[model samples]
Target: MASKSAKKVNLLDHNSIKHILDESVTEVVKNQGYVEDVRLSNAKLLIGTSIIVVALIAQFYKKKFPENRDFLLACIALYVLFNGLLQLISYTKEKNAILFTYPPAGSFTSTGLVVSSKLPRFSDLYTLTIASADPKSISANEPVHFTKSITGWFTNDGVLVEGLFWKDVEGLIVQYTKEPKKSK
Candidate 1:
């Protein structure tokens, strides 16, 4: 048969496959940043709103209790101090630290791979955990075709990644291994 003479060829070349995987991984990292920002933003909004409400209440009732004005003033001062401290720490130290810790050994899946060394904590002092399930069909450390569908989350000191495929992750590692090509 004429069809028998045709041999099966890979639909994607190595470079194209790599490019696709890299883009997928980049998307995941971007998503992670967006999620982290939302969390931080929500926290800041809550703190700012609480401080404003309490300060307003204290000012409104200050005239009713002339003798206790000092106490209310002290409370407002403490609230402001707390807000300042949080901003100082968050901007100075925790600014860039709020990123997803990439796996160093090149994780194909969650199994037999280390995700993070130092766990990050929330403002509420809760620890975070990142979890990703390994594919049953793939062997440990084995590479697979990259397709981005990993759903990860931050839950009380944890991150959950579902169906972690490595093709999407290779981009993160490739930078470390190869130098960028410079244009002449």
Candidate 2:
């Protein structure tokens, strides 16, 4: 009888992994960006419409009550100035695509703290502390802290913490440090 050896599964190639990460990030950014654009457009339209309506009303009142003309003019000027400022601020809002790259498959030490970037709060790119099982292993069982310097993908699905073969490693831990900055 011949003895059979178990086949080892190699990790994915770096390019393949990068391609997958790129596709996923692109999809998420595009969807979110589109929603933001729609909201801004609607706000601009509403403010413009309100200004027009107010001007027309002021014109009518000015003719009938000439004494109130000065007050009406001041109100209209304020409205127009506010509207212009709002438009300027909206135009300056950031809408550029955020480029994300996933780190290559390798072992890293766990700092025991995980943090997320400010770009996407709900589901965003995160930095994690990956613990090593053996002192002689890739990371030498030290705490690994990945900053924004190390690129990674955004995933709502959490990573696996426990494995059957690793002995020195108690387990893996992942946590988000803070919420992302909210948009207006």
Best by TM-score: 1
Task: Give the 10-residue window scoring lowest on summed lDDT in candidate 1.
Answer: 117-126
Give one digit per residue, the lDDT tens place, for model 1 in 1-184. Answer: 0112222222223333333333334344444332222444566678878888777778776366778778798877878886996788577534433343333345443342212112222121212112222325343333222223222211222322212433234343343224345599
Question: What digit string (tens of lDDT, one per residue) describes model 2 on residues 12-113?
Answer: 334333344333333333332211124445666777778777777777663556688777878679678868866684555322222322221242332221
| lDDT to native, each model | 0.40, 0.37
Task: Quote the lDDT for 107 in model 2.
Answer: 22
Q: Give the TM-score of candidate 2.
A: 0.29
- Of the candidates shown, which would achieve the greatest lDDT relative to the real structure? 1
Report the poorest 10 consecutive residues by lDDT, candidate 2.
160-169
